[model samples]
Target: MANARVDRLRMMLAREGLDAVVLSHPHDVRYATGYHSILERWTQMEPFAAAIVFADPARPAILVIPEANLGIVAVLNRDGPHCTFDEIRSFDMLNFCEVSRYVDPDRNGGQLAEDAMAIAGAIRGTCQPDIAAAITAALADHGMAGKRIGFDEHRVSAAVAPKVPHDYRDALDFMMRVRVVKTGEEIERYRAVGRMADRVIAHAGSLLHEGADWNGVQAGICDFMVRNGVIPVDEGAMLFGGSYDGDDFIPDLFRTPGKRALRRGDIVILETQGVLDGFWIDINRTAVIGRPSADYQRLHDILRDAFLMMVDRLRPGVSTNSLPAIGYEHLKAKGVPAPEKLLVVAHGIGLMPLEIPLAYPAAGLAGVKQGFVMEEDMLISLDSLFFGAKLGPCHMENVYAITAGAPEPMYAAPLELIVADHAPADRASEPA
Candidate 1:
């Protein structure tokens, strides 16, 4: 699996015109080498460490990983070269001579240990003061006094002393420039996750009722994701009732479901999660208790059409900004609201649920010249949501790959509203 990923990384290196690239970021490291923690003790102390990738157009790929992670590296590359291993205990500048062979292939011996020292210093300060002290000595021994290297500005702290010069790029950009686009195997795994989410959501929808509480719904969906092969231990799903009705309600950043039972005329927004190989697919669907009003139905129709129209615009050469514009025109032509003002277009989705190359627009985002260029293999989400003042919440969601032609929806669950028939026994006096 990682052999293919390494090949893609080499291609990226060639495109970027970089001689060799080092990956100390956990996500980047995983993308390149598929090395996860077998050394739980050291991982807890320094969970964010990774190996450097030195790509030479002429030679084979070389990776520098921790000695404890050798097993993972071995499994990741059963058919490829055993990646070079560096012991974490002696990770300072003094012991970096071994890495020089991989880093500076032309040099006979001498340590260009600036990056290792900087990485050691950064991880040392996290929770383990003892490790911090040890890595401080490593930097001094390595002679990484002055060198230009790229680091994640978003992650690297202000307190850490700068041992080397750094290039500032948004951490999202650095990662997505390499990862936003998926490989054939990655897309297959992603499709599997989406199918799992679709089945789980469908099962949850079938078991719904007017008396069902938020916990009941969440329990069913959670079990389904786990049974159908999704990483079950994430933050899980959020069930919104009538409490968060306004535009100010940011949906579920950190809110859990309440004791509110399903009632007649209530719209239930189900945002279930699916994970395959650490990549994520978030698909949200709205289920209505009893049939909805004509006005609510109208909004759902408009949003559905708009969602398809926006997704149809994705291709290899189109701009990310064009998505929101097309969605706006789509809704406007149908006599609905604008996409930007309504916030109902597509967005980026990947390992973190939301990646960069966002499909939406913002002020000063025009001419930013960033985001998905609709390149082949880029995985993104096309989600259209409607928050009605007269009704409740509605969402149509799917994952898409930017191909040479049209965008492909990874998950193909029903796009329209799923209506449930039941009367609210406790709210007989309430008006619809």
Candidate 2:
């Protein structure tokens, strides 16, 4: 799998006249190499790690890792479709942390180390500069000493940057361009995860009651997913519920969950975010606590139409820049109000919820440049968050992967307004 990814990257890099590239950012490293650790979430330090990819097939990719991470990274790639890098180089922070102690950092600690010297000369050859030397040695050995090098310039480490003897271009650009599409293996993983998340959404919708707090609904969904082997553990994995009772929806969709209680006739927005294996799904569905109002049905119908209209155009040959006009024409045909503001109505999804091929200001789709062209095997989510004071807010989202024939929805959920009524035994006095 990684071989295919590397091949695709090599072709793109060749176009840009780059001889080799290195990955240092966590997400890029994970996607390119399939070597992920919970520790990669560090905001301050990533232990200054990197994974190198040389354009020359004869020369293998190398990982510049802190001596501490070598063993775990090896075990991580042991049975997975991870990068088959030929070399792994190690660096040491002799004072704050020792290379010897990292042989089994979390497990045996110093127990894994053999007798070491007490003199400073013993550790003199192991320091920050040593990390650069290791990388430079690889480049010199490969005849790439003065070739164009690619890396995330912002995240580059001083200890690691000066060793490169060539021009630097942001590796992020190439990565984003290629990440728009999903491979067969990635699509399968996403479908499995979306299925699990769909069940969690349905189960949580069933558990909604007139008086239940958002916390209960979130817990119900998360616990169900975890217990059923969807999420491996409770590592801050979550679900969110918002009581958008009478235009109270949090426009910023990613706000943290609160104890807002569901009242009668309230439109409960439940978003289920689940991680299966390593893939993620971002799905949202609105359900009413009791009977939904006429406006609820109207909003659901119009938004679903808008969403489907956008999705229908998500074919391999389609230009993503045409989404807004397609949506406008569809709304006009359906006699629904034309959306005044079109946000990220469609976007690609993969190892993360949002990937490349995204719409609007960032990709300049809504303005100057023609948007990203859809390629085969791209996974995307068509979203509709159209709203007005009179129309109320309805958030509808679903996942799909573009194919040669037609795109396919990952979930089995029907695109309709779900009227979720609480059982009599669970009912209580309606709140204002």
Candidate 3:
């Protein structure tokens, strides 16, 4: 299959007048070359892989990786359509195999010999002493020497500037602009991960009991996600429940989960985040232990209705800056106390949790204005949170794919407050 993501990067580079882009960010490399380095999980300061994309459509993108990963890249290309690099180059890092010795065809005939030959071919004339030298050589070979090249990371740009003769510029904002829209494959991966996270959050609701604590719920969520082929992001899951500081009830959403046990009628907010392939899954749901009070129910109903209204308004050409106003007006009309406290944020979500058009504000980010219009095939998460001092807190977050007609919810979870009852009599005796 053709890689549409690389094509998009090339188009963006051409439009911006950049000759080529050298990307060292782990997520940027994966999005460009479809290669995920194991070293990315260990360190971010030292990049073990890089991707070089030229503005010219004819010049194929190159993937510069460590020599240790050549075997896995060969295997992935042989077994499936995982790796999407047009050319593979390597640099000497931690070597995994002895390059001097050849695999005996007689002893390892079928797959081993084939893989060995592929690895040898990949590293034959492309391996360099280090990442800077490897990228410099690739740029020179591709006629990009002394050209206007964009670097995604500032540190990588500074390190490579001394070695390569090129006009380097920062391209972090350029990269975000290219990644705002999702391709067909990326959308499919998002949907798949969204379905998995929905199931995981539902499992979390089942674990709610009188004695259930945040740590236990988080542990269960992690175990469940690992068993189901999704990698948990960060703390696996975040569990926040309502509590009373003194005579007044303080609804704090930012409190870290501890050993405090969950009690009946306490509102709980559960957010599940995971990754499948290269896409991220972030969805949140709120539930109450046993029955909810009338005040809590009314508050949740108003929030849910407001959430639905905003989601329905998501379509092509709708300004994202206007979404918060729409939500605020609806909440105020419904007599929601402190409607200004309701935060409505809409932003793209794919390779990362927060992508451009950033929901929150920053000092200097070009092309990331607040009133940007939503486009088709843009995967976004609409997050709404309201913390009331008396009624506790309520949050509703969901991922949606902007389409031609109506926005499609990536998961099958309902947008109502979950009323989690006590554990069954038979299962209550078992350990959590």
Model number with the top lDDT: 3
At residue 175, candidate 1 shows an lDDT of 51
Candidate 2 wrong stretches, greater than 4 Å: 45-48, 77-83, 93-133, 154-161, 225-260, 341-344, 357-370, 424-432
Q: Could you give candidate 3's per-residue lDDT for residues 379-409 as a string of tens digits?
A: 8788888865567788989999999989999
lDDT of 1 by residue, 86-148 (tens): 323222222342443355566542232433343333222122223223333333334323422
Candidate 2, 250: how far from true, in Å? 6.3
2 or 3, greater by TM-score = 3
Give the Å error, residue 382, model 1.
Answer: 1.1
Model 2 vs. true fold: TM: 0.80
Specify the poorest-scoring 10-residue window by lDDT in model 1: 122-131
lDDT of 2 by residue, 9-116 (tens): 677778878888877776666666666665665454544566678777666666665655555554564566354455665565344346355355456434222211
**Candidate 3 structure, TM-score to reference:** 0.90
Best by TM-score: 3
* Candidate 1, backbone clash total: 3
Q: lDDT: which is higher, 1 or 2?
A: 2
- List runs of model 1 lying over 4 Å from the truth: 38-45, 58-66, 69-149, 153-172, 232-235, 239-254, 333-341, 357-371, 422-432
Scored by lDDT, model 2 comes in at 0.63
